[model samples]
Target: MIYDLLIVGGGVNGCAIARDAAGRGLRVLLVEQTDLAAATSSASTKLIHGGLRYLEQYEFRLVHEALAERELLLAAAPHIIRPLQFILPHEPSVRPAWLVRLGLYLYDHLARRKRIPGSRAVTLAGSAFGAPLAGAYRLGFSYYDCRVDDTRLVVLEAIDARERGAELRIGAKLVGARRDGDVWRASISGADGRIESVGARALVNASGPWVQETLTQRLDLRSTKHVRLVKGSHIVTRRLYAGDHAYLLQRPDKRIVFAIPFETDFTLIGTTDVPFSGAPGPVAIDAEETDYLLDSIRHFFRVEIGRGDVVWSYSGLRPLFDDGALKASVVTRDYAFDLARAEGAPALSVFGGKITTARRLAEHALETLAPFFPRLGPAWTAQATLPGGDLGPGGFDAFLAEVTRAKPFLPPSLARRLAGAYGTRLWRFLEQARSMDDLGEDHGCGLTEAELAFLRAEEWARSAEDVLWRRSKLGLRLDGAQQARLGRCF
Candidate 1:
């Protein structure tokens, strides 16, 4: 049987496209080389903003579209994607206060904000937001963006796709594909050294950093458009400040650094825009990148952060469209698609997209490939809720309350964590367990044997990293011994 679509990569773009296509009544198959979001998607700064910094580059359309999608995402998945307030401390040396206000105004009104509030001016002195900051930085502007559990977002899309009848094959690497008359036969190698062949009428390449390599080497297809890999690394440390609000600091180099509230106990600081040229696999934060991030944090906050203060660090490569930009930060974050058809089989390659616009990108991708499959349904993902996102009209807090009330045996913190991570789907495991002992062996950090088993059985989590880092951020809370113990379980 020939599938209507076969997607490469299991990042946000690929999973989102698969979910959309399957909902459109198409036979879809998604193949990923590793676990879902094992690369760039999971390693994001985890914000769903309109790329406020891009506005400086005059990327109005991109900002507007992203803001619109931000609203939609907040509504669709409240548990994972929620509104986050960003405080931009005034730095006269970087830009005047008025210029900052003007940018905030544009951001607020760029696309009609629904639930998110507009921007406003505020004083940092004597305020909770400024307690962690130096007295020198008193005045600043505040705006709203969003914080998301990036890995969960990717996994949710894949789960939704599978629920909608799309076949999801994780740990399957696409080795090669060639057009065979009206159908394309693709070869994929699994983790166990087994290769399998599948056929599809249309193919999609949403391999993130691997987009160009997949096109030129895997498929042996020639395309003039190439992707530039830009590495963005983040460092997680103990909570630097109080309150749920985040900070957007301006560097002397004109680049922006975000110090956001990460887990309940950590502050996430990141993102350097350095050009990279090498294999886009398992990128680690170098000493220079670490120093740069630490310096950026030290420059803004009164707290002194050093390399030793770093708890955990991660890096991801962004596959930006190579448009001759001298700086990696200036390269377009917008996505571009190259469509080629030969022997009646079509292949569409995607390049340079952020998590904010991935949903719209998938919609547009389907629209681009609509002509190839006439029976495909219309766009429907905008108003739809992702897997486990159905909290009804009561919202996340009310849902958590309901879960706790129903399962009085659950601890408040554990119940809250489970509700936020799984939302309505928490019942799949919780309904069976009566007490903490029923959870079967605490792996430390609130991760239980039951949860790990659920991840392996339901979410396709295959390794310790997949469970600890991608499935949930239990890695940050667990010690080295605990992590090794968890690893032994798998």
Candidate 2:
């Protein structure tokens, strides 16, 4: 069978494209060399945002589109993606008070905000948001974005694509491909060390950081544009504050840092923008980046944070479109595509993109290749929901109540975590379990055989890291021995 589209990479953009194209009745095959969301997608700041900081860079269109997508994504995946209020403590030194208000005003009115509330000023004194802040901070502003289980978003997109008849091959690397008349002859090396040849009408390179490498090395195509590699790193520490709201900290250098709640027991702080020239692979936070994050947070939060306080740290590279900005932070977060259809068998290479607008990016991608496939279906993902996203008319809170009532045998904590991770879909696996014993071998935390089996059979989770780290952030709770046992099960 000749697939209508062949995609490379399993990051958010790739999965989103597969989901969109497959839903449009196009036979699609998405091949990822590693696990879904194993790279930059999972290492994000974990916020589905319009990038308020981008306003300073004068990226109005990017911010507007992202803000619009923000509301749509929240509706599509209510369980994993929900509204988050952000508190930006004013540092008069950073910008004049009028400028801050003006920026906030524009952020509120740039796009039509439906579920997310408008931005407003807040007093830092004697308020919950100000409790952990330094004495110097007296005023702040609050606006809503969202928090998401980033990895699960990618997995859900891939799952949706598969359900729509898209073939997703994890642990499969594209050895190379050549344009043969009208279709692409692609060689893929599977996990079992077997090579399979397939034909596709068109090819898409959504290889996030590997976009350039895939085009040049595998397809033997020279890219008309270049992607600037920038490294962004994050650190996990014990909860820094007492509210559900996240803090946006300002640095003397004018860069911003976020301190948000994570996994119910930790604070997620991050993202240093340093130009990266090294080959894209496993990246870790360096001593300098660590110091920078700690120092930036310390200026606002009264608590003293050091290297010892970091429980877990991760780093990922952003393959942003080269916009010739002197600073990495100033580069545009928007996406672009280079279509090589003039040469035969339309080959589209994706450039810079962020999680906030990956769905829109996918829509535009299909639109770019529409001429080749005249019978392509119209765009439909905008009104559709991803797997397990429909929480009924009552939304997540009511859905949680319903699960709790139905599963009286489940521990409250376990029930809440399962509902948050899988939403209404947890019933598929939990329906047979009557009590704690029914869950089978405890892999530590609340993870049990029932959930593990579901992940392995359904979610493409191949190892403990996929289950503990990406599927759910229980790695923070598991010990070394427990992790090893869980890995062996997979």
Name the top TM-score candidate.
2
Q: Give the per-residue lDDT digits (tens) of candidate 1, residues 1-490.
A: 6788999999999999999999999999899988899999998999998999898999999999999999999988898988899999989989998888888889989898889999898888888878888757789888999999999999999999999999998988899999898888999898787988889999999999999889988888988798999999999999998899999999999999999998888999989988999987878889999999999988888997788889999999989988888989899999899998855799999988999999999999999999988888999999999878899899998999999888888778888889989989888888878788988898996788888889999899999999989999989889899999888988
Model 1 TM: 0.98
Error of 2 at 159 (Å): 0.3
Compute the lDDT of residue 309 as modeled in candidate 1: 88
Indicate which candidate wins on lDDT.
2
Question: How many clashes does each candidate structure show, in the order listed?
Answer: 0, 0
Runs in model 1 with CA error above 4 Å? none
lDDT of 1: 0.91
Local distance difference test, per candidate? 0.91, 0.92
